[model samples]
Structure formats: C-alpha cells, structure tokens
Target: MLNEEIPDVPYHVNGVEYERGYYLADGIYPTWASFVKGFSCAVDKKRSYFTRKQAGARKDIERTFGILQGRWHILQQPARGYEVNQMRRLMYTCIIIHNIIIEDIGYNLAENDWVVEPVVRMQRTWIDRCDTRKRRTKELRDSEVHEGLR
Candidate 1:
C-alpha cells in the first residue's frame, strides 16, 4: 500500500504537464486532482466509454490483488508489524510465486513471458523536502487539472 504522499515531480499526459500523480477512484472520493474518477451516470457516449474502461481497469486490479491475497494469506492481513523493506520483499516474493504458478498452469504464456532485466536504482537529492511538499500539495488539489482530466 502507498502512503498517499504525492511526489513533487511533473508528469505528462496527452501533451499536458501535471505536477502530481493521480489515483483511480470511485465517485465516493473527493473531487481532488489526485483522484481520477469515472462518471457515475455517464449520459454521453464518451462518458459511458470512459466509465466502462475505467471500471474494467479497476476491476482487473481488484481481481489481481484478490487472487494474490487468496494465494498468500499474509497479504490479506494488515502489514503493521512488518517494516517497509520486509513488506516489499514479502509482496515481491508472493508476486514471483504467483507468476510461477501461472506459468505452470500455462496461463497467458505468450503475453506474459518472463523477461529478466537488470534493475536500475536512481538516487534522489532533495534541497528542501518541506517546501517541495507544500508545492506538491497545492498541485495535487488543483481543481483545474482535475476538471481537465475528467
């Protein structure tokens, strides 16, 4: 799980620059730039299409995590006692095992072939973390960007 902290990094979406990352959420979530929600009623064709796609994507994510949780009961429970590093390792191990099982069952072998690549770690240098956070908060709550995304 994420801490829901937005990094002060700029990203591009359809040639537009956005300062904060967004999450796919339901209509129940607040109207913040960080939350990209689909239309509840979807009266128009575009809105209906968007709603279907968004709902499908969300369902896919939920199903994937549900399978992982069902397979690894540890993932089903809260990770309060475990450290961040431990949680990471546990999640990675479960994913790897899940992948192996999927391979053994011959599930989507052509589309989901295992590709081993070297991991590259990048180091971040922050001058003033607090100042960056303040700016990020404002960017995340920008209603203009939220409407534009919608």
Candidate 2:
C-alpha cells in the first residue's frame, strides 16, 4: 500500500487540512507521516487523553479479532492455501454469524441507541505517477509531519 501512488486528495481534521492519510499505529512502528502513534510518556492532560484514547481504540480492535479467532477455529490458525478472495469471504461469514449470535443473545443494540460516526471519504482527482518510489518513500517517512500531527 505504501509503494502505490498516493492520490491528490485532502482531508480536514479540527479545521486542519491534510492531503495524506495515516494509519493508527503503535510505538513499535516507525515515526512516519502515515502513522499516528500515541505518546509513550505523556506529561500534559491533552497528551494523556490522546494516549488513553489511542490505547482504547487499539484494545477494542484486538478484542474484536480475539473474539473472532476464538469463535472461528479457522481464523485462529494460519490461512494456508486460501486465496485472497476466499479469506475475505471467510472473514465476512464469520462476522455475519457473529452478528447473528449477538442479535439472538439480545446483545445487539437498537438502531437509535447506536452511535454512528461520520466517515471521511476523499475523492482522488489525480495520481502523481511522475513521482519516483524513492520520493514517495521520503514523503511518507517524514518525521516532521508526524510530530505535527501528533
């Protein structure tokens, strides 16, 4: 995904405009513009809040994958010999079954009770095909932008 051409699209957050998208990462990942990692030693209340929130989000994702793995033995083991499409279908099937179970067990919440977040979908106007791989790599690994975003 990093090697591909980035689209000339922009996203706004807190009134700030960003043309590049980023991933929610952990401390182990590199300090790059594309990776939004939490501070290890937060000194201020704002940093503490951000760190807590990031940890919570990561934990939620881990818990979900853990639940899926526990319920589906196929997911617990390596997906050997399965094609990409097959693996995708398997994951979807597991999720659908899991949702069904949630509804059956009265764990599912009503539509009105659910908190729906707005998704930011950026429209790509053009791709920078002229940019070389090295240039793109440098842009992605820019630590200055990473610190600013953090």
Instruction: Identify the candidate with maximal lDDT.
Output: 2
The models' CA-based lDDT, in order, is 0.73, 0.76
Q: Which candidate ranks first by TM-score, i.e. highest?
A: 1
lDDT (C-alpha) at residue 92 in model 1: 85
- Candidate 2 structure quality by residue, lDDT tens digits, 32-135: 98898999999999999998998889887678778877866647657887888999898888767767877898986557463435544445444544354567
Q: Candidate 2 — worst ten consecutive residues by lDDT sum?
A: 114-123
Colliding pairs, model 1: none
Candidate 1 has an lDDT of 0.73
